[model samples]
Target: MMRNQTSSTSQTIRFTLIAFGLGVGLTTLVIGGADDATPIGTKWWPSEFGPADERGAANRITPKKVLEARDLIQDGKIYQLGRLYEHGMPIPGKRHFSLTIPGLPTGLPTGNNQMVSNDELVSGEIGQVGTQFDGLGHVGCRVNGEDIFYNGFKLSEFGNPYGLEKLGVENVGVFLTRGILLDVAAIRKADRLPNGYVIKPAELQACLDTADLEIRTGDMVLLRTGHGKLWMEDNDTYGEGEPGLGLAAARFLTDRKVALIGADTWAIEAVPHESDELSYPVHQWNLTRHGVYHLENLDLEELAADKVYEFAFMFSPLRLRGATGSPGNPIAVR
Candidate 1:
């Protein structure tokens, strides 16, 4: 029995020594490979939040932080911002600025001298077209794997009900912070990034390096692939084509602790990888899982040429109660 115990003790000591040696070797390799001047936190991929054990999940930028970032941009200390709107730019859809109200009064007086004027205030439906904000309630995962509106809020919620009175647009209020634009197209030296191409982590890092910028806490990062231009030219191809960030890049951004993410494309992430696709995983990962906001269909051509890495961001969503999203007109000022 004494000899057996001694043998077990020897095995334990040997195992401990092996583990210690392996750990030391790994540490040396990592330290040696990293750039000496790289910030401690920058050397390795940073956690979305400060630490795992802290309250809340990863990549959560508080509202207060956003406000502080915004103030800096407004002071003209930062420059290079994107223009959200391009005049006469056609939005790819069946209805860009069309109005369709159900049950219009039939047999209205039709005469050459007929006049339709609003002499008194009456309320029904208003602005149903043009640029708009997409409120949080605009989209959601299926409760049982089926897409359904929350509380039966009609599609009209995309417009009307302006402000936070109904949908808490007030919660979003005015966002002031640093804005970073990643010109992915320039990195690849392509006039436009092809559709269906999922951007990888290495590619994203390369693009950032080319731009000579690093993401700071509470930054609004906008990724431009020249997809918006293609989208404007051909909606069908743009909607179904191969452009956008991949899951890995999304994870990296969330891990980097960005406050909001925007892209010049439709869906932020590459279409789901599965043949039996369910939900947009990026949306799930960022919005539902990580509490990160997404901005889509932004016009970023001008911003890319400006070579701006930072700016003041501002946006307000239409206040619609019981809605999934608000068609917001978001803008960035340098």
Candidate 2:
């Protein structure tokens, strides 16, 4: 975990609040005493969407929500909020992203015509690569001798070698709602927050106050930490760790009933983690506990630079049947 120190970026810092730093909330929650039979009280099963619900938070995108989102558009200006999917981008563990064209023409010329074609094959963890949408089926906690996913769905039902049969990316509909960018780096008076900086609830409130914007239910919130500036420029350092929401911050957004949360970093939660025992606790807290989805590896630089704090954000994940996630570019318009 990187300590809170003066970042090397040229952008001047504004807010002088001490960096909340890392390893904050994990100590109080777990006593290191729970067994497999012990119930996970984190909010699972019998969702508000009903027992058989598969779409999770996407159900919040009702017609009423659509109209509300459309109302935010004024100048018709759109900002692309997804990052480029290229070979050099940093990835977690053994995952990767790459593109290639097999041959010169890539395909044969048309008969009796001058038309030739080029086609490229994309190879990578399609659902997990750049600018990805994490579905309910994507995360779960093991308990009672089974791996439980969203709505207590077991791995035996949806987990498959080919694709997930349930809670797949196809189950999620679309997101069209008010997008709020909490530019934490800008608010903290830093071009980029140091790695492992755990964003606290106090910082979030200050950010909202700074923007004069309040987070409403079903809002898609984006946290801009400026970590993305290293994207494609330095893959190794980018993959090391990141500055993001702590457990407290996760609870803050989840309690507000936000449909989805995105960020400029790879994971929405702080890297190196607040707890070494819990694997992606925020992912579980939102996806399993409350069904709030997460969008990671986003590009919010343009939007941040323009100071577009609030706008209409929309993105449709490709309906890849039985896939855990979908790769696509999300857009924000003001």
Candidate 3:
């Protein structure tokens, strides 16, 4: 565990230096480009929010939008969209998670009351673990020898070893918006989508048609691929690959100007992706290009069972200064 953390730290430092230099050859490629000719800077920089905006699509959540979302709550039933963080939960890549009590009684019997207390010692990546929230800092595209994030925030200008000087998770404020769930599994007539199945725009349209719904601006969209069924019961399989959206489907949502996209799967985009050459391109398209956020490893079983397709979705990322992401239980109120 220490070794993994050490390696991650070193990689962070290395990447920081490389980004700061702006001329270093090393960079994480942004695959599945629109064309070989167009530069990423010209295509997606100076976001609609402007050059100085760090809030991204989240800026669309206005008082009117909040009232609009508030109107969605009819039943007053709340659904927890996040999964429990445990020792055996399915974690992606080399990330780690563990929780332990420091002692039988962390605090000795104090005062005359003979009171004792227990405290948990949590060790691992807190921000990017189970039920994670991806901030603007989470993903970036290296364009023309420079690492650029949302709103054209150049990593060379903001990258730091300790933490990002900009685009950190703390910059993302509260998200209270109309939330829609597209149960692609039910649309496909399957309990669980087969691994590596790519959800297309047609399927998304079909789901919306059935629900008599439309993706609106500043809405939070959740896709239930049913891959979450394997979460802890089959960790190995859950981590192997997933059934999720293709680039076109992602573009379909971004076209509607959604504030965020979430999924029952760990990664919202299909694993063993639509293109062998691009890895998690949907992530790049949404986070980097559109300044949208992502919520992952959601528990949508109750919502599916109750047939709650639209509701008031709300979540606030932890104010972890300079952190890349956050972990929290987002809720849906109907």
The Cα error of candidate 2 at residue 218, in Å, is 1.2
Model 2 TM-score, all chains together: 0.88
Write candidate 2's Cα lDDT for 1-334 as tens digits: 1122222221111100111223333322322243312123423677888988898877877788788889989999999988878766767777778899888788877889868889998888888877888888887766645788888788987789888888988888889988899999998999999888889888898989999999988899999998999898887878788988877788889888899999988888887666453456677778887889999988999999999999999999999999888889999999
lDDT tens digits, residue span 125-234, model 3? 88888999998998876665677788778899998878888999888899999999999999999999988898988899999999999999999999999898998899
In angstroms, give how far residue 332 of model 1 lies from its true place.
1.7
Candidate 2 residue pairs that clash: 13-189, 14-189
Q: What digit string (tens of lDDT, one per residue) describes model 1 on residues 220-249? A: 788888877764577566666447775557
lDDT of 3: 0.81
Q: What's the TM-score of each model vs. the native?
A: 0.60, 0.88, 0.88
Candidate number of the best lDDT: 3
Candidate 1 C-alpha error for residue 171, in Å: 3.7
Better of 1 and 2 by TM-score: 2
Q: Against the correct fold, how does model 3 do in TM-score?
A: 0.88
What is the total number of backbone clashes in candidate 3? 2
Question: Model 3 Cα RMSD, Å?
Answer: 7.4
